[model samples]
Target: MTPIRHNASGGSDNDTVLDAVRDCVLAVGVRRTTLTDVARRAAVSRMTLYRRWPDVRSLVGDLMTREWIAVATGAIPAREPGTTARDMLTEGLITAVRAFRAHPLFRKILDVDPELLLPYVLDRRGASQEALLELLSGSLREGHADGSVREGHPERQARSVLLIVQSFTLSLRTMTDEDDPDLASEAFLRELRGILERTLTP
Candidate 1:
């Protein structure tokens, strides 16, 4: 669940808590990051922080959600004739994959506490997946109106795309067992992009 964005009493926090969560998670791991530590890092009192989030997990969950929403929103370009819905969707998924690969915090989580990430990915209607599905469904409807997407239920199509994106992007090693994991991961992404393009294109 997302924590309240504002500081105590709705002040101009400007993401101070999220920033603090990221810092604390990086400095220590998720298991060790306490509400006290986050409040100290954010320069707020523990009570003030608790007013927004009950614990560190809740706060970090919000942080991860915000980071992903940023990636998804930034992935799409302004609509134009040349940019079909498929194109926008493909680019957005690629952006997410690349962002995850490059994100220090995400990598840190993977190394320190991959189990923390699994619930969101494994649940069919988890918060993260639902957020992405909502974004994709909106784009699909727009595409249908413009005759760029197939006539179907946008939610179903979006869920399918989300599953594909998550399956391949999250499970990198299954694609290839190259000695250099970095190179293997890149190669896997290239293949994933092609598959998604074919799957989503009308």
Candidate 2:
């Protein structure tokens, strides 16, 4: 799939517009947010928004891509002198799951227009997911070289890891029980750590 492109120039106007889109979505949802509302919120002309994004869905797509990539980038574990790639990957995935769950835009989307995620979840990969897969595959390759991860095709392993992470990120709420601390989200996150460790261990 062709990745959704943000403004190639990285202009402030793009940021302004996307920020407006975020606010609109958070307030109403993707379905209810209109290009007019976004334009008004952004203080940009309707023609300006139309020139870039054809519709609210396209605008929101770019918004989500931007938000999700930012979250994942921030969640990447920094390399330390003694940190193996496997260790970094495991930590990064766990951290990303936590960050994604806590992200305001993410929570808003899940709470409101969850159907917007159906295509990415059930049919095709989105730009953010593809970006994450690239990061995961690179780290998996490094882990293999360092003898810390099991031998496997990096792309395949990355996909598997992403699948696991997606389930935890999206479906974990259903399995959690706030009433019972044992079944809380953090408990599942601990299980996720064990699962990732065993999956990558040499």
Candidate 3:
């Protein structure tokens, strides 16, 4: 059996290892963050980490997911009454994009191994889907009930819009050096807002 660390968190040692993964990812980037390094940072043992995460990629994937969920739920509030659905959505999309783009850890991952981010690209089971689905659900429900978004199907539409937002957000990382990333992002959001406006009434 691998060594395990326990604490008041009461979470599994796997959670501890995952937290350590985040620290190492942020401090040293994914490429250099070894199981040993994570263990050292968490004051756990290598065997403990290995027992939980077999390798850096799996660990990185886990951390990436938690980071997205934390930021979406923690940084943004749910839709409020009298607020246009489009506005809250725009803010949330922009916030998520800016956070991902400005994150040193995420940037490092993009710079080193962009494919790590793609496993969730418009896919059914990954960080992008899970985090966004959770974050958008509340807002969509609110908007639909309040008559902000179109009344046909709240959940389905929310998922579609969120997938688009994530796609645009992810694409920002790949813009040409000569292209202005912010301008491109803004333009994309503008077009997206137009689509949203068409779908929302009253």
Which predicted model would earn the best lDDT?
2
The per-residue C-alpha lDDT of model 2 at residue 75 equals 80
Ranking by TM-score: 2, 1, 3
Q: lDDT rank, highest first?
A: 2, 1, 3
lDDT of 1 by residue, 96-195 (tens): 8877767888778888988988887775465555677878888888778767767789899988888887777667756667789888887787888898
Top TM-score prediction, candidate number: 2
Over 4 Å off in model 2, which ranges?
Answer: 1-9, 180-183
Tens digits of per-residue lDDT for model 3 on 1-202?
Answer: 0112222122666677778787887777777778888888788888876776689887887777666665555546466776675567656666676677777667777777777776566334674365466557666776776666666565677677776666666675465344676677667667766755665554
At residue 167, give the lDDT of candidate 3. Answer: 68
C-alpha lDDT (0 to 100) for residue 148 of candidate 2: 96
> For every model shown, what is its TM-score relative to the native structure?
0.86, 0.93, 0.76
Give model 2's clash tally: 0
lDDT (Cα, tens digit) per residue for candidate 2, span 115-142: 9999999999987788878888888888
- Comparing 2 and 3 on TM-score, the stronger one: 2
